[model samples]
Target: MSSPRGGTARTAPPGRNPAPQPAPPPGPNPEPDSTGLVPYPAEVAARYRAAGLWRGHSLPAELMAAARAHGDRTALITPEVRWSYAELSATAERFAAGLLARTRLRPGDAVMFQMGNVAETVVTYLGCLLAGIRPVCTLPQHGTREVAVLARHLGARGLVLQADFGRGQLPEQARALLAEGVIEEAVVVRGEVFGKAVGYGELLRAGTGNDPGTLPYHSRPPEGVAVFQLSGGTTGLPKIAPRQHEEYAYNGALWGRTLGWGEGTVVLYPLPIMHNAGVSLALQPALLSGAALVLAPSADIGTLLDLIERTRPQVLPLVPPALAIRLLEEPRSHRTDLSCLTDFIVGGQKLPLEVAERLRDELGIAVRQKFGMAEGMFLLTPSGAGEWIRHHTVGTPLSPLDEIRILRPGTEDEVPDGEIGELCVRGPYTIRGYYRAERHNASAFTLDGFYRTGDLARRHRLGGAPCYSIDGRIKDVINRGVEKIHADEVEDLVMRHPDVAHVALVAMPDPVLGERACAYLVMEPGRAPLTVATLGAFLLGEGLARYKLPERVESVDALPLSNVGKVSKKELRQDIETKLAAETV
Candidate 1:
């Protein structure tokens, strides 16, 4: 898929390449995850499944239930639109019917959604869910290379995108997919389209024509994929983690209850709605509780504060650490009426203790640290927990059925409590395997089905509440804000430069972004050294997204090595931090 935005298809470096496998051919009345479903021993699967944990209900069903419970209550809010529960449910039903009337897409055919946090995205997302089309959630920042590759990998039959996101060429990206015959249906939202692609308004209008009373809608069987959640891998291209309907619905319901959320709760959602955090943690929970979900225009402090002042949201979920800091320090914050703020859910990485303390003591907003992964399990501090427990640790799992083990690094042996170790998890919501990735699944999960989440964590107790605190990460990935940049992916791109002999990319300390990528290079014999500008230009020319570029470059004679002769990223990481500390001083 060649991009009209320029540059040929990006050749993902070794560590950035996904396995060369695709899902099974499209079929009628298929189980969603079974396309690449990793089988548990048949006997074991049957016995476990007999527990009947999966609820296999459609995504719309969850919202419809909420609508029935509170039809007149506000369900979704944006700068331009407000949808009550009953209205939102009716819209989704119409949108689902329109999708069926407009596209030839069948059940189990993957449909990718690349949209912003808008009302239309929600409508189309619910439409896909009720239509039995598995929607693959993708961030809008993903360009042609990322989108095309993911579309191909998942065998997506159609794509739904917005034209007015104010970013990269959305239409160009959609055209590339259609030009390559990668997708059969094109559902463009919030824009005019004259081509074979269907317009968003047209879809809704067509749906209105379809008799909602006659439309097919029912509960899906348990244990089928509901949505494909993208994984921010430590050493490879994004992997698809298929979430089952039953377990996923359970995750939303339980977390909502655990956080003491129900009808009348108003939440300010700032993260990307398509992401796992936005969908599972924020959107779904809010809908299940019959709460009003008011999406932030952007992550900028001005926008968030403006929304807070106008909407008076009772709940706020923020991922960027900088936002919390800015909100507390910004001059406007002093004037803004923040009394309506009840709790702030900080999810990406650990928020510093001092920052959480400031939010509590200064702003009077309780900080609930949340640690979750796309693979399934979510650990969030409850609303009314003790100060230390709420601020310091991510409380116990949402589901009592969830299992966690703090294992010694690289081994399955359990570590003693209070000792930091690799976190391995297995539960109803967590995925057993990645889609169609046999080898990756083999490495990512244990034989008994525990996902080795590269996060370093330790079990602890605070005021009698059993909880876990994240210590650090063993994975070679950089979390700049909530965005993860894999070290290997960046290193591979740097290696392609002629001026570099050996290259290593490491995360550097940052006050705002949390971490920015810095590249260390050993100059090739007789070759010129490189600068951040030149390297950044090269990476951009090579189709790397601007956000993934290395912010700093350093000349090095050699990279430090581990005892096993492999490059020790740990040493490099320490060196960068030490250097940054000295520079600051």
Candidate 2:
């Protein structure tokens, strides 16, 4: 945990900082709201869960059932093309048969697929299901380096990859890995074919006339792993989180119900389908509930908005940072025909309370915050709630088979209600441990059983509903020795300054003290008076602890953001460390 990427460990600001410590943690019994929905205890949550209407089944079975029910209905719609359920099912069946004919990839055999957001990606994923091949979905950024690491660790037999991803050539890198005996076979999708690398078209041809009915091989048990999603790779190398068939299917159904999606709903999946939110909110829900999925890459925001206008989707799932910044910069006139949008589901990153308010007040759209990770455990603010809670709270826990506990970080003791603690969860869908990393798993999980979410949250009642509010990340929180300052709180305070367009709070190296908060700011084009002292005064006036106040402020043209539109704190922290080192010299 000591500066993962080679930067000095951060510490509190140097000075006799006088700020009152946080109030004593609240006791278990909090007053309920007038509607009897707020401060809902475990008993009340149990009542809501007691309906016993949860859908727990195998993913393949659910896919087949949907295809049978809506044979000709449009299932997946891309900008360039449209695919009917029948057509997709047929194609997947053929592709699965082709995989079988080409390689000895049988049930339980892991195959790594490095793909982007495209139609072929979906087909490949479905094909894996039909063949009972465990598909490990990876980002386009992953080349031989990542693929080889994961392939060797997972004992992968095959690699399905896009020909060109960004600047990397899949054929060349894949060939290197193959030569090194990392991966046995390679199935290249998109563009030209190569020696030993079978093109998608050629492979599918072998499976032509394949019976769609016999597809989605059922040799593996329902509880067996179906998909392998990599962890955030925060602690040096990444770890694979395997998802089971039955629980994965159940997650989709539960998510569909939470979103209030039915057969007529059309979801816009602009992000990569490999992501949990993209799959759960858009693809899985659409497929399981017989709704239509609109696929588009999120790289081009304008194009995505255009697609939204054309498709008239009912639900739009978006990560907060990108859309929030867009809505702030772009005029209302640019948002075309969003009247069809019922709710804009935001997740993956911190959703500023200000952004939520603006969307609700200006666009007249509901901003529902959802919190989840790839390993599983989806907690959503129940859909169609009052505007206040939907905008602020991340909703209640949705999974019927899930259990949640907020324990003091570095300790097994559970914190009292209304107190921030590390969120730990265990459930049918949530992975018990990381794949092939006994050491990592031993560190990540509890003695009994629970995947530490690494997120700091507090139980809260908002708009008469019981839910958890994300304070910030344990890793990202600036530890000021005597007190811990959550970056989100600091960001929220600094964002209130009209001159500041966006802000990121990162820990900078300190001499005597361990670390001090360094503010990286993006200001309005003509805005001025952005200095270290000015920002420090603003935080002090806002009642932030002196240690919590930014000791240094670096004004920039714009904040560095990740591909997903979140302020890349990881990158920002690095930048600050570099600056600190240079200044020290």
- The lDDT values for all models are 0.73, 0.72
lDDT tens digits, residue span 54-102, model 1: 3446555665677779889899898989989888888888888888888
Best by TM-score: 2
RMSD of each: 14.3, 10.7
Once fitted onto the true fold, the runs of candidate 1 whose alpha carbons sit more than 4 angstroms away are 1-34, 39-56, 213-219, 233-237, 462-465, 476-585
Candidate 2 per-residue lDDT, tens place, 1-585, comes to: 011111111121222111212211222322323321112233422333343322344577677788778888889888777988888878878888888887767766889877777888888888888788888877666657777777777788888888866665777888898899988888988766777888899779988877765655655565567778777862455677777676677678767766767777888876678766666667777888788888885546677677877888888766566566675566742455678888778887778777787766777767788888888887777656776667667877665335667889977778876889888876545766676665666668766456788999886645353577788899987776667778889998998888987888898777767778888888877889478788888878989878788878888887776655567788988998987789889
Q: Which stretches of candidate 2 lie over 4 Å from their true place?
A: 1-57, 213-216, 234-237, 332-335, 462-465, 481-483
Model 1 weakest lDDT span, ten residues long:
1-10
